[model samples]
Target: MTNHNYASRVQNHNSSIIADLLVQSSDPQNISFAGGYPDASLFPSADLADAFQHAVADNTPAVFQYTDAKGPQELRELVAARHAKHMGYPATADDIIMTQGGQQAIDLLASLFLDAGDGLAIEGPTYLGAISIFENYAPKYYEIPIETDGINLAILEQQLQANRGADRIKLLYLVPDFQNPTGITISVAKRQRLAELAETYDFYIIEDAPYRELRYRGEHLPTLQSFDTHHRVIYVSSFSKILAPSLRIGYICASPTILTAVAGLKSAADIQSPNMTLDALTYYLNHYDIDAHIANMIPYYAKKRQTMIDALHKYMPSEVTFTEPEGGFFLWITAPASLDLNAFMYDVLIPKARIVYIPSQAQYIHGDVANSARLNFSAVAIEKIEPGIRLLAETFTNYLTNHPAE
Candidate 1:
């Protein structure tokens, strides 16, 4: 029998596999390399507490009331200045709109551009969170392949050229800096060409770069927005990786015309991001040195990344290969195409070894790939890194050995 009536969109919207694994991770015995979480030890607790206290004490009744839908002007100005300095682009307060997080920024853009059956392009093995959000609109997904440096521009251009009518993609989503599941960064030449393609094809690019500032090893490349001669790039980023996730602060940088529509959608969605949090973040940025805080965090996360990579090198089998990311919370692993790592996890790895990592099935829109996984390094403790990876490596080797290629 059917339950109460529900919207058709509800059928397509389902919870992320990461969410289910997060619940499993609550157990003390289970070791998880699954969720993409930042280390809590690095958060600036004291400074944030002071900032919140100052915001409430100074703003009083004013802070308690409803603020602008675009968020407090002071915070927007600060974000614009910081973005301009770091991202090698010119921005002003008018060009910025704060959101619940970068996740909301992406959703808002999807709302602005997508309709049912509209074309949407994303990196294959993309961030799972983005997959969940984009699914709500039921857009026709073009799962573009990723290269060692970034998304395959050649293939993407072909798709753009071929689909020039009603099926042409309206929006393109990318995590150019140390992409979430793959840990690959797009090259400078591709960034320029991507911007040019967007102009020629008449589509907008959503540059969702939450991990851009976490680089531990390479020189910083310019943001996609910097290369945008036309206002076709909507840049989204967050403080969740650099600061605390609970803060729920992120911003969208785009042309004022675009932001006006996004702000309306945001206002309808949640009214606005919490006012007190915005004020507190503003106060924190004013008084504290976020750059220095980021500097301190680099070595801490860098150590964890190195530990995970070393463990992989020491233990992984010849058939299995993994990425060596310069900077990011996660790295990817690929096995023989026929291995079916998802089934191996449920039937063998989780029950026998008490180990968990995100399988490649959940990473793609259609969930067709079956022999890869995304392993997060920053969340697990330094002591558990080697053991978790070692156990995983052993399990994989044994499983592959016992069930040779069919």
Candidate 2:
């Protein structure tokens, strides 16, 4: 018998709650509302195929060779320019470090800044993937309750005040624009207040904003990075949602000091993101009008969002509460307190309903949100949403009726 011991970090870490369930339940016929994946139908396959061919044919030897550790210059410039124009940020190529994807960007940021036992603040119900990333470093996780507008400022200030010490906290991780799981956009006032807090506390802010450009309704608010005069914000985003996830190209904008350090860390980690993908994306961006491409996606997602919302209202019990997201792919659902969502999922929703959802327990840093679940309407087709929600509602009703608690 061979025996081996795993590292403490690896042993202590829980497997990705949402991803584990997704893999287990994934079926071609299954109506999945679990993953944060974008709609595959929206991928520009023909255009990307053409761009890939052109990139290899035109660049030849260069396309096959390893490029700069900072990524191809053209792709970086394109990302900088696009963000500057669309996001109202003063981003330049020098301030941007191209990453493999948004996940890598998060990992690199965590690796560069955090040490074990340090404290990092996050919204109560936040992006689970980010929480997973930070867990590897074993940071002391603190949660600030989330409101409809954004992170509850009062709770945030209280947490910060309580945690103030000479050791100094590491970072405040936020997804201000169309946050994952919650799908709540932080208002402009909150963005300003968050910037002020970062400035006052002298801590860095990691704004993971993969879904900022996927707005289906309402005016776009300025990013927290926009108000960051002290260069305290690290704004990370990806072309994954807008273009294609397979390309694995994303970038981070921060102070030259921080970006330089992150670039070095990235170089040691992955050398550089594939130049072929970057070149292809750059070709696509240069040749095509990206704004028009994104504009087309808005209506597609808008209809899907409406479909899910309408179905939920029609089929769900009136006691169930959910948020109407202005942008992004998720609807945060809070079921009646009488229901144990985790038990309901395993006993009823997954088995009887034959549907998959990210139970809200996966979203919390401390694993305490027991009665909530997150529904993603982006990847699933609009036609299937009605029936899927019906299944979900039926499961909820069944659970409530069967497991009545006084």
What number of backbone clashes does candidate 2 have, counting pairs of residues 3 or more apart or in separate chains?
Answer: 0
Model 1: how far is 251 from its true place, Å? 0.2
lDDT of 1 by residue, 295-378 (tens): 999999999999999999999998999999889898999999998888888899889999888889888988899899999898
Model 2 C-alpha lDDT per residue in residues 149-186, reported as the tens digit of each score: 99999987877777777445659899987789889999
Q: Tell me the lDDT of candidate 2.
A: 0.85
Candidate 2 has its poorest 10 consecutive residues by lDDT at: 1-10
TM-score of each model, in listed order: 0.98, 0.96
- lDDT of model 1 at position 215: 96
lDDT for each candidate structure: 0.91, 0.85
